[model samples]
Target: MTRTLEWQVRVGLSEEDGTTRAEAVLDTGSEKLIGHGVARCNPQDVDVPVIGDELAASRAMKDVAAQLMKAADHELETVGAGPASGPVAPPYAWSDTTA
Candidate 1:
C-alpha cells in the first residue's frame, strides 16, 4: 500500500518552587494521546532551568512513546494475525550488553 502518514507532537512545561512539570501530546491523524512527567531540583543542588526542562521533557516523551506502542499493538490483533505468544516485546526493546 502507498500511503503517507504524519503526526504532530507538542510539549509544555511549568515550574513552581523547585518542581518542574512537563506535559506532552501526540496527535495522530485519528487519535490524540497525552503524557505527563515531573522533575524536582534537589534541595542542596543549584537550580538550572534548562536542566529541569530537559529532564522533565525526556520523561514526558518516554511516556508518550509507551502510549503509541500500546495503541499500535491493540490494532495489530485484528490484522488476521494469530493470537500473540505470551507478551510481545517492542522492536529493539531495551537491551544490555552484559554477559
Candidate 2:
C-alpha cells in the first residue's frame, strides 16, 4: 500500500540580547506542536546574522523532530508495539538500522 500526505511547518526568527531565537510550528493535520531554539555568538566570535539564523533554525527543527518522534512512538504503543529503540539522531539520521 502507498499513502501520501503533507505536513506544514512555519518557522520564525528574531534577534535579541545578542542572540537569535527561532520558533517553529508543525501542523500534522491532527495535531500541532511547537519547537524553540536559540543561538548566541560568543564574545570572541565574529557576529554573523546568517550563521545565527541557521543555527537557531536547525535547533528548532531538532526540537520539532523530537516531538514528532514522541507522537509516533505513542501511536505505536496504542497498538501494543514497543517504543522505538536504537538511534535516529541528527548528523547521521539516514544510517541503516538493519543488522
Candidate 3:
C-alpha cells in the first residue's frame, strides 16, 4: 500500500534576562506534541544571543524527539510488542579527534 503522511513542526523562541527559551510543537494531524527548552548565559561568558537561541532551539527539538520515541514505544506495547530496550543511538557520535 502506498500512503502519504504529512507532519508539521513549529518552533518559537524568546530571549529575556540573558536567557533564551524555545518551544517546539509538532502536529501529526491526529495528535499534537509540545517540547520546551531554556538556555542561560553565564555572567562571565560573552553575551551572544544567537548562540543561546541555537542551544535552546536544539534542546527543544531533542525534547520533541524523546517524546516521539516514547509514543512509539507505547504503541508497540499496545500491539503486544515488547517495549524497546532503550533509546536509539544517534546516527553518529562526536569524537575528540574530530573536534
Best by lDDT: 3
- State the lDDT of candidate 1 residue by residue for 1-99, as single tens digits: 999888999999999998999999999977888999899999999999899999998899989999888777776876746346576755776675666
- Global lDDT of each model? 0.88, 0.88, 0.90
Candidates 1 and 3 compared by TM-score, better number: 1
* Candidate with best TM-score: 1
Worst 10 residues of 1 by lDDT: 80-89
lDDT of 2: 0.88
Residue pairs with colliding backbones in model 1 are none
Candidate 2: tens digits of C-alpha lDDT, residues 5-94: 999999999997679999999998988999999999997998889999999999999999988888877787788785456753464366
Candidate 3 is scored at a TM of 0.81
Q: What does candidate 3's lDDT look like per residue over 1-99, in tens digits?
A: 999999999999999999999999999999998999999999999999999999999999989988998798788778978545766545358754653
Every model: Cα RMSD to truth: 2.9, 3.7, 4.6
Q: Deviation in angstroms for 73 in model 3?
A: 0.1
Q: How close is candidate 2 to the true structure, as a TM-score?
A: 0.80
Q: In candidate 3, where is summed lDDT lowest over 10 consecutive residues? A: 82-91
Reference-based TM-score, model 1: 0.82
